[model samples]
Every structure is written in structure tokens, then in C-alpha cells.
Target: MSIEKIVDQALQDGYLTPSMEAEVGRICNTASELSIEEYMALDRLMGALLTGEVVVLPRKQFINVMEELVLSEAISQAVEIDKDGDQSLDVGDIAAYALNRLPPLYATTEEGAQYQRSRAKEELQSLIASQVKEAIARNLDRAAQNQTVLGQISDTPLLEQMNILLKAYAADYEPDDESEPSTPN
Candidate 1:
């Protein structure tokens, strides 16, 4: 959504949600330059925040119990794998990959989080382990593929690179006459 829309929503709701804040941050970070209206909208949001008109929700108020479970599983598996000194896996990547495949267990209170943890352990431990293993395998495969691809790219000639790119992106691409330098009239 546009910054204006987000700001308007916040004003109307009297609270800025974490997702909304993240969206605003993402938009600002990705944009090369903000329009005047965008800046004005941000200014308005800031004013609202300062004046207690729009309360910014605290990020610490919520937790995803699944993330913790995934991290724990990933770390234990990673430690054993790393013992060989052959493969170095990214625990975070494995955790994230597993998390994507697993169901989210979000909680707003300590009691809720504890309950979710117990439920996950009882019903999802095996699934979580299997997903983590799959994530690790995929990560390893991708790493090997990337290394091979990078090696091939470094060895390829510049003309060959251009040809490969053209074939992939524009199989029928042709140079336009207008693109060429023209003689002075």
C-alpha cells in the first residue's frame, strides 16, 4: 500500500500495527526517492505518533513459537553436521526454510506461547525434524549448484556471457537502428 493509505489507516485505527510499520519501512528502504506527498504522509504519521494520536504497537508484545522450535531443531542438527568440518550449514537458513513449511504458532501472551509449545511438541516434532532435514539437503544442493555456476561464469568468455544472457532474456532481440550513433547533419 501507499504511504498515504497506511498513514490514513493508522490515523483512523488509532494504532500502527507491526506489519504496517514493516511495510512502511520496506517501502522507504526500497524507494530511491520519496515523492513530496509520501514525505508529507510520513510527517503526518510522525506527528500523530508524537502527539499520542496513533500509538505504535510494540514488537515485543507477540511471539512466533514455531520459530523458536525450528531454531532449536536446526541448531542441534547443524552442530552434529559441523563436527565433521566438511559442511558448514546456515542454521538460520535451515530454520527459515522449515518455518515456511510448518504451521505458524503465534502467541500474544506467555501462557499462550507455552501452550503452543506443548502442542507443537506433542503433534509436530517429527514433522519439524523432517522439514529441517529437507531444508538442510536443499541448502547443500543449492550451495553446490551456486559454486559450479560461479566457476562456469568465471571461465566463460564475455561474448559467450552476452549470448547466454540474450538467449535467456530475449531470444529474438535485435539492435534498433535508432540506437546506433548517427553522423552530424
Candidate 2:
């Protein structure tokens, strides 16, 4: 029997656990630092997986990190598309960037081409959603932290009021009693 058949049988028999899958994914991640071209190739491979033409069970973490890397690079490219020092991208800019960055799918029929275009746009939109949410969350967290630090350091009336309120609040909570006179007596 061929090695492929043996591996297939092993997988079918539930011999491949999550740990093994994670280890394989980690190894792949370490070995291949995927560039834009490689990202496109991986997307094509994902098409096969989506269509059930190929069966792959990569670790969730690995898939997430891979998608993050691709999306980060794509976003970076999109942001850099306009060098006007605007520092932000509009929806049309992002849409155009996605269209340009993604690989073209050539189909013989118009319907097939339209289907491929829709699929590509849908996938890119999903990527945008995940990446944009994460970016917004990180930025908001950082902003909140900076605001607190600034309030504490700046000599402003608001900081003074906050400090007074904090001290009052702290005064309300007494330390635990440390008396041991009864035991000693």
C-alpha cells in the first residue's frame, strides 16, 4: 500500500489529534514566511478546501495567524496607496486596494467570472471585518490607557478632582485589624 493511503487511513481512523495538527501548523508557520504571492497561493488552496475538493485540518490558531498576516500586509499596502499624508483610508480606497491586491480569476464564461468575483469580494470583506475590528479594539484600549495616564500626570482641575475623589474612596476602605491583645493576655 502507498504511504498516502496509509496516512489517509490513519486520518480516517481518528489518529490525527489537535496537538499533532497544531505541531504541523507551527512547523509550517516557522518554515514559510508567506509573501503576497504566497498569500495568493494559499488563498487558492483555501478555494479547494472550501469546495470540499481537498480536506485539511490545520490548527485554528495557525489559520488565524496566517489570515492576520495576510490581512495586515494588505491593509498596510492599502494605507500606503495614497501618499498624501492623510493617514486614513476611505471605503473606496480599501475596495480598490482589495481588488488590486487579490489575484485575478479567469473563467471562460461570464457567469463563472462573476461568481468568482463575488466569492473573492466576500472573502476579502470577511478579512476586512476581522482585521478592522481588532485594529479598532487595540486603538481604543491604547487611547483609554493614555487618557488615564495623561490625566494623572497633567496639572489640570479634572486631575485634581479625580485625585480627591480617589483619596476619599481609598479612605473608606480600612485595613484588616492586626490586634492580638486578647491572645497575648
TM-score of each: 0.56, 0.25
Tens-place lDDT digits, model 1, residues 59-120: 87779999999999999988888897687788889998999999999999999999999999
Clashing pairs in 2: none
Candidate 2: regions farther than 4 A off: 1-70, 77-120, 123-134, 137-141, 154-185
Name every residue pair that clashes in candidate 1. Answer: none
**Residue-level lDDT for 89 in candidate 1:** 89
Give me the overall lDDT of model 1.
0.90
Separately for all candidates shown, the number of backbone clashes (residues 3 or more apart, or on different chains) is 0, 0
How many clashes does the backbone of model 2 have?
Answer: 0
